[model samples]
Structure formats: structure tokens, C-alpha cells
Target: MLNSFDQKKQKILQEIQSDDLDLSPKGTIDELCIPIINLINSNDDMVTTSSCSGRVSVYLEGTKSNRAVVSKGNHGRWLFVTHEPHDLKDWTSKINFVYTSSFPDPNARLILYKFEPLILHVKCRNLETANKLYQVAMNNGFRESGIGSNFNVAIRISIKLDIPIGYKSPKDEEFEEDILNLFVTKDYIKYIDQLSLERFEENSKKLNQLYKAIEKDLSNGTVLTIKTNKPNWESKEERRRRMVKEGLKRQEELRELKQDQIQ
Candidate 1:
């Protein structure tokens, strides 16, 4: 099992080094969470598969008549995305352009949504290592962290948070209102965006500190203990269903392996 894990880790690391690194909308590994990614990859027991540092986006919802179909299409077309704080004027200008473009469809709305809390997926050497990483992540405020495995990859750790940052739609009046209302305005949106960015920064710092603490505990030959609130994000039934699905996948893989060996 250990040998299998090592081989898989080597293959994944090679893929990462060979230009298969993250270059998506979520940004690259270095841009997302370099320090933590570096620290985890440095260990022989782990390698990050995917991650996102979180983002604030201006999304344009599709037409109301075709809402169901368009929701299935591209519900949130990203007009803009930022990992850091943005200028209010820039956002306002962009919003105005989108609002004007969708003139015929009054129901067509431009929404600003902020996805707070970073997400990181790490493949560990074994179930034990995955559990350790999950615990450490939970300690660092990633209450949504969990452990899972498949036949090919025996251990996977996910680090995340359940904080709902931005989903509220700004009032339509705010666009035409001469006087800015506290509820909806370009400045208000900027303020909220800035707050979410600050929270992301704070949580990122905590993650770094947690990594350092884990390192210290390992050096001292002591088990790390963390005190944190119970996670209520996912229900037990949901988790059980997911685990059962993974188990079925693993069984199929093993059957395939056996057939290949016999042939």
C-alpha cells in the first residue's frame, strides 16, 4: 500500500512539474496558496491536486423565459473576477455596461457574488496522513475539511470553509437611484468586497500558522490536538452516500486489475 502511494505521488508530482499545473480561472497553484502548497508538497506523504484562494465575481444571469435552460447553460457568466480588492469605479463601469447591454430583458440582472474561504485538495500517502491533514485543516478554521479515497488514490484530504459571503442581489433601483442607498450602491459593493478580501487574507494567514504548528508538533514528537466548533455543513447521510459511491468505484477498479493480471 505504501509503495503504491509513493508511486502515485511521484506520478502526480511529475505531471505538475511537466506543465500540467493549474492554469484555470481559479489561478495557478502559486497564485492560489503557494506557501501552504509548498509546505504540503515538501512532505513525502502529500501532494495538492487542486486549490482556489476564493474570488469575487460579477455574474450575468440569463433571461427569465429561458431561465431553466440558461441556468443549465451558464447561469453565472463571469463578467469580472478578482482575487484581491478592486476599485469601485472599475466595477461600477463594468456593471453599467452589463446593465445597459441587457436593456430588452428587464429580468436579466447582473449580480455580484463573493466566494469566501479558500479550497485545497491534497492527496496523502495513506488514510492516516489524510486524516492528520484533515484535522490540521479543521483546526485552522477550514470546518468543511474531510477525507476520502478511491481505488487508484487511497487517501485524499480536502480543506475548505462553509461561510456564505455574498449571494444577495443588489436592488435594481441602485443602478438608477440618484442618491445612494445603504442597501445597494457601488460603494457598498466595494465595501463588502473589501471585507471578504480581508477575511480571505486573515484565513490564509491562519492556515500558514497552522502549518508551522504542525511542523513544530512533529519535531517535538507530539500529537497535535485542536479545539474547534463541530462542523454542520454536510449531513451524515450525504457523507455516507459519497463514501459508498467511492467504495463501489474502488471495487470496480480492483476487479479490472484482477482481470488484467489473469490475462
Candidate 2:
């Protein structure tokens, strides 16, 4: 029998590789471009090979592309993708996984790397946890960028995960719904603190799982880089003052132009 970690990896690889783009909606079709872009960003070159593993499903939002991607493995299911913001790169990073979720869900696998441009490889066990995690991460401050409207991404690399069955969380359902209350704004630092607190208070058991997985990575010297949001210092007043100065300079030049015109 495959070890727990090996099993999870296999599960993730199979799901992503088997996704049907045609059956997928326009928004999902767009997400496929994400890995291609990420591969480029990571190496400034397209990846010759990329794949996804696990049984993953996506649901779209009515406006823009509001969708959540979920994954299922022998172990359990959790939210994988919350909101499919056009820029899919926003949803990826690398981490350690004993069973992926820091718990056992292969879909919530956190793939980590060393000395690579920071990227988080996210594969959640279900859409609910995926959505909740995204909201919480964004509420803690994260941003997505890249790709014009024409090119949307749906599928990307897949990895397999093998986890023992019957590890799903019942609380995650309620947590997913409450995720809407989270947001990434100027007060993001506060939100991050609140989220960390809530995470400990609400889901200490699962948090311990994630902690163990991450602990292994740290011990092995696998660097983890998470993106953080900071407030922009320039305010409307500062911007306006700079603009006004430029406008005054233009007016002076206009006056000189009239003098030259008359002469």
C-alpha cells in the first residue's frame, strides 16, 4: 500500500489531468491558463509538462466568474477554490503536506519549493474549504494579477494524494458560509490577526494538522513564502497636491506659448 503522502499526491495528479475543458464553463476554461502563466513566471518559460491530481469540481458565480473549486479524495473533502478571480495565480502557493491539508485531504495539499519565485500550489479537498480559505487569505490581504479578459484559465497541473478515509470536517461547512464576512482592505493586518485568532479558536484540531505538515517542511529547509498586503501610503491629498503642481507648470507654459504666438 502506498504511504499516506504518496497516496495524496496520486489523487491530486489524477483529478487535474482528467478535467474536461468542454464540460467546463467559460470561466473555468479561463483558469486553465493559470498554470501556463505561473510556469512562465516561475522560470520565464512555459512548462513542458504540468498536471493536476484528484477529483476536483468547480462552481461558477453569476457575475464575472464567481466560482469555487472543490476536491475529493479517499480521506475527505474541503473547499479548494473559493472565488476564481480572473488572475488564477492569486490562488497558488507551496507548502509541506503529510496528507496535504496539514491534515489528510490531498486536495488541500500545500506544495513548497526553495529559492523559487514565491508561488502557492493550492489543491483543496472540496469547494467549501477552498472558498473559506481564499476568503480568509484575501481578508488577510492577497491580490491576483495578469492575463487579459480573452484568456481565462480552468485547468492546470495536478498532483495525487493518498489519505485515509473519514477525515472530513463538519464545522468547515459553517465556516465556509461565514467566510463572506472576511475581506482584504486597508485594515488587512487587523483581519489577519483576527483570522489567526479565529483559526485557533474555531478549528484548533485542523490547525494542528496544518501545523504538523508545515513543521516538517520547516525542518527540511523548504522555504515557505506567503504574500501579504500592506496599505498604500499615498492618499488623495498627496496625489492632488502633486497634480496641482503639474497643472500650474502647464499653465505657465501655456502663458509663454501665447507670448510666442503674439510675437
Candidate 3:
């Protein structure tokens, strides 16, 4: 089993080094987490299969009422994406164009801005290695890390953080009015755009700190080995015998208690 696992690991490492494999949305690994990725890949027992440094995006989706009436049906479309902070004026122009454009049905004009968190998937050589990695990730603020599988490849470690930011019904008049009052701005759209950008920057910095923590533990060999919840294998006969023994022990205790009560 060890030999077979080693062979598979070598094959996967070769594929990762080759140019044919693209594990990122933009065909490039995230620069922010590149050091962490390199550290994991350097280990003999692990390799990263996919990763993302997270992003903020502007998108449009049709309303429920519009979905049934539209010929092509309602679908979400991304208008912009950035991994770093963006200017308020830049997003304001894009949002205005999307809202004012006639190509999208009037009912499909809800624009939204969103922030996503950093994510990474690591493939471990075995379940033990996966458990160690999962422990380290959870300790470093990646609370969503866990084990996933792909057919026979049993130990895929998923690392994720769930920091999300979004605007709902950005083009709604009442919503716009409320935000305009709060920010004291006649250009309420620009105000919201700037506000979202600032929040995104804050969340991005938090994610970066988490990454650095993980990298530090990994480099310093401080990651702890914790037992995972994976079940142990047992034959049907062995399980049946164990259950029978436990039942017999319980019966003996009950009889002893009854006898003592009678005495």
C-alpha cells in the first residue's frame, strides 16, 4: 500500500509541475498564498491540487419574476473581479453602465458586489497526513478545513474561510435612498461602492494574516498531529463478537445488582 501511494504521489507531482494542469480560475496560482503552497508542495507527503486567494466581484442576476418571462431565462453574470482593493469611481462607472444598459432586461438589473475568502485544496499521501494538515489549518483560523475524497484518492484536504460581503438589490430606489442618507451623499451608488471596497480590503487583510500563521507553523514544525474522525475497519464477525461480549457483560452486572438488592 505504501509503495502504491508513493507511486501515485510522484505521478501527481509530475502533473502539477507540467504546464498542462491549471488549478486556478485565471490559470495562475494566487501570489499571496504562493509561499504556503510552495511549502506544502515541498513536503513529501502532500501537494496542492487547487487554490484561490479570494476576490471581490460585481455581478448581475435576473429577478424571479423576470426568469419566467424572459426568453433566454435569467442567469447570473460577472461584471468585474479583483483580488486587490479597487477605486470607488471605477466600480461606480461599471455599476452605472450595467444598470443603464438596455441589453439586460429591466427586470434583470439587480447588481451585486461580493467578497469571497481564500480557499485551498491539498492532496495528502495518506489519511494520517491529511489529519495533521487539517489540524494545523483549523488551529490557524481555517475553521472550514476538512477531508474530502475523489473516488480512490481518499485524502483530499480542503481549507476554507467563510468571510462574505455583499450588497442586495443595489439598484432599488428605497435601498439607495437609505444608504444615501446614512452616508450623506447625493451619489449614493458611489458611496455604497466605496464602502464595499473598504470592507473587502479589511477582510482580505484578515485572510492574509491567517495564511501567514499557517506558513509560520508549517515552517517551524509546530503543527500538531490530531486524531481524525475516520472510522476504523473491522470485519463483520469481529464486530458481532464485540457486541455479544458487551451484551453479556451488561447482563452480568444487572444480575449482580438484583442479587445484592434481595440480600
Ranking by lDDT: 3, 1, 2
Q: Best candidate, TM-score-wise?
A: 1
lDDT accuracy of residue 170 in candidate 1? 42
lDDT of 1 by residue, 52-161 (tens): 66555554443355646324133344445556544323565533332121122234433435454566778876677777776766665666667766411222123222
lDDT of 1: 0.50
* True-structure lDDT of candidate 3: 0.50
Candidate lDDT (C-alpha), each: 0.50, 0.29, 0.50
- Determine which window of 10 residues in candidate 3 has minimal summed lDDT: 177-186
Backbone clashes, candidate 1: 0
Q: Name every residue pair that clashes in candidate 1.
A: none
Question: Where does candidate 3 stray beyond 4 Å?
Answer: 1-25, 62-75, 87-89, 94-109, 150-263
Q: What local lDDT score does residue 194 receive in model 3, on the 0 to 100 scale? A: 60
Relative to the unseen true structure, what is the C-alpha lDDT of residue 34 in candidate 2, on a scale of 0 to 100? 36
Q: TM-score: which is higher, 2 or 3?
A: 3
Candidate 1 regions off by >4 Å? Answer: 20-23, 62-72, 86-89, 98-110, 151-183, 217-263
How does each model score on TM-score?
0.58, 0.18, 0.53
